[model samples]
Target chain A: MGEESKKELTLSVSAPSGTSKEDHASRRTFIKNLAIAGAVIGTNALVAKKVASVVLEKDPQRAYLEDVLPGDRVMMAREYVVMTDEEKKRLVKTLIENYKKRLG
Target chain B: MKREDKKTTIEKNIEGSTRRDFLKKTGSLSVAGLAGVATLMTGTKDAQARVTWAEWFQTNYRLMTEEEKREAIERLEKRYSEEYGKKVTVDGRPAQKNVLFGYALNIQKCIGCRRCVKACVKENNQSRHDPEIEWIRVIRMEKGKFSAEDMDKGYPSDYGIQVGGNAYKNAGVVLEGQHYYQPERVPEKDAFYFPIQCMQCEKPPCVKVCPVRTTYREPDGIVVIDYNWCIGCRMCMGACPYWARRFNWGEPNLPKEEMNPDTHYLGNRPRMKGVVEKCTFCLQRTRKGRYTACVEVCPVGARKFGNLLDPESEVRRILERKRVFRLRVDLNTFPKFFYFID
Candidate 1:
């Protein structure tokens, strides 16, 4: 028997009683593509979701600023306790002034 | 003789009346004093003071109401300020509201000099007693072989010696040859010092396991636990693959002299007993546009922390340039933590 005819005989024997050639080919292609798509989309989605959430919500520079202050530097920058009304106003004014300066 | 006897009788009667009066006053005072003492004892052993491990297991650490969280923050801030003599602002702003933090470490460059570890302890108000509250731990591991067991054999002998013979002292040692091995060190190379902390995983198991939703991933990939909301259930600790989370067994042993007063609502303020804590990526510092304490204190430029979204950020550049790998990639935790071996 020729090789092609022998392959055809094997397929016919293995095939379900009524399965079509087109159906088998399409199923094979679908499974292959589905796997490829799953891998590509799965990883991309995971990384993108995390990055997007962080970028959308967090101010990276601000977070850095809050963390970088040395012990001595923080002491020098002395966060004033808002105890008395006068102290509260002073602190508020200082913060506003600093913000304005930075914006400028 | 009769007159004298009358006088003596009168004196005896007066003494008996005085004794009765004294007894009545003493009886009233004793009752009042006992009541006061009882109240004082109850105050010490109030509902807030009775913390048990079983109670902790049942209590949800994450499901605190806003009011409860605020009260906790207030208490933390007060404690810090009192101890440190500096004003600490416990910002209760939502993680997405104002601040963001990210972290990175280069395994190739870290020399295992535990400066970052000490710095984190000091900066984060970590308990002197436990020293495990802050979000950093240096894990030594072997190259080619990834498991801890492979590195244990080489660990003891590698102390204080650089990877190359004493020749490369003071110069930046790049892993050029196979002979380079980490010496006996707290953090050693050959064995890479993987400083593992909150991976802030995209799908944080800590957040999922939290019964009260006290611990949640912020909009910026930072996972935070509301200490007030946390009923000290150590579910977060159990769920953490990196072993980054810690539970306060007692009131945080903060000495008045060593507290950092510049606090953030979601970041390092003095923590209370019975709350689980991990690294917030130094949110207080990061929120204000600064580097994390560990990153800043690293004598070698091993630690890099920045926005992964920013292509220009140091973290992004390292990720792009190096063959970086996250811990436990098999688990699909999607940890923000990364490491590179040269």
Candidate 2:
């Protein structure tokens, strides 16, 4: 078989039983993106997890919020770190929302 | 041939050098010329804009001689003026012998407006725009039992939330006792406010933990930091029970116009990235017999500051009269900041 057909056969074999072609393609895309993300990050897993948390959440202010609940505080500018493009997008969204709230 | 001998022979050539030699010489010369031009073009105009060895190796505030202090202050003023593009005065204002600072807050009166937070950011040259830093943290707590003891116990209660919260309360609705509380209007019906800053503790744990002695209590009883000498070890920040100290993780930004021109050597002076800073009772203002920015900006008359040594001072009167308590009194930090009720 040609390279393309061989790749298709491998993907089909990897897919769970009864999964559709669309689902298989999406799974392949997801895995590819995940791999790329893993490669681009400079820090260890723990810090990446923290960096992800910062992107996804902005409440009760800081990561060390022992007092503020996980979601109530706004992100302070001081906690910024280098981030990937996707992470940067999420951070921008979080910051705008935080600005709207005008958190001290 | 030895490379050195060949180069020497080429230089001594009476018939002049070859095309290769001319090309090499010209290329290197042009590259060096370009570098020189680039440096000149990109240079900051202020001749003294950079930190000098004298400034870098300056003695600590407490240890500096009178002459040394004058030189240090002059260097700081010139450098800061260059950085900000405006004339700024950096003065070494000593605490008065008869003065011992103290602070009191009427908790009930503090509407949790956080005005004090803003005033502090402006008065002291705390970082603004990027990596925002605040010296004061106002924790909002539900009208329930909470203290340093509860904080030590861990979790929701440690943060001032009662376990098995009001059954009628909506799910994920219970929130309290956190350092960052943003309510639409402060004094949220069933909650109260606790503004925390450097307590200017008589026996500050933050001062004790500084391995470099960068932080110390002034003779006037106000704890201050020599930002220049701090090694950014964060030991003082860790030791502060009140969470008063802030670290500059990156280069801090403060615009020229927003820069507070008036500065105290150990207080509101513009700090570089990587130093630890906290409220010094607004040393620039306080040492000169003025109240802290928080005290003056307080619209409700909730914040009071004065000389603790004066028998008739407002702080002394409050101590004598009000039902006052210091956070974590059990630790015996002897913090000068007090929370009181009328």
RMSD of each: 32.6, 21.1
What DockQ, between 0 and 1, does each candidate earn?
0.00, 0.01
Off by over 4 Å in 1: A1-104, B1-76, B83-86, B93-101, B130-134, B142-191
Q: Write the per-residue lDDT of candidate 1 for residues B1-342, one digit (tens) a residue.
A: 355446546755755565566567667867976886555433243332232222333333345577666665665565555546677677766543322234567777886677777788888878776323445655444443345443334322447543423322222222322122335654543444445667878668888998888888766668887665687778877677666777776556778678777777666777777687778888877766788888899888888888654557886566555556565545657677666544
Backbone N/Cα/C clashes per model? 32, 9
TM-score for chain A in each prediction: 0.32, 0.23
- Please give the distance, in angstroms, between residue B316's alpha carbon in candidate 2 and its true position after superposition: 0.5
Please state the error at residue B188 of candidate 2 in Å: 2.0
- Candidate number achieving the greatest DockQ relative to the actual structure: 2
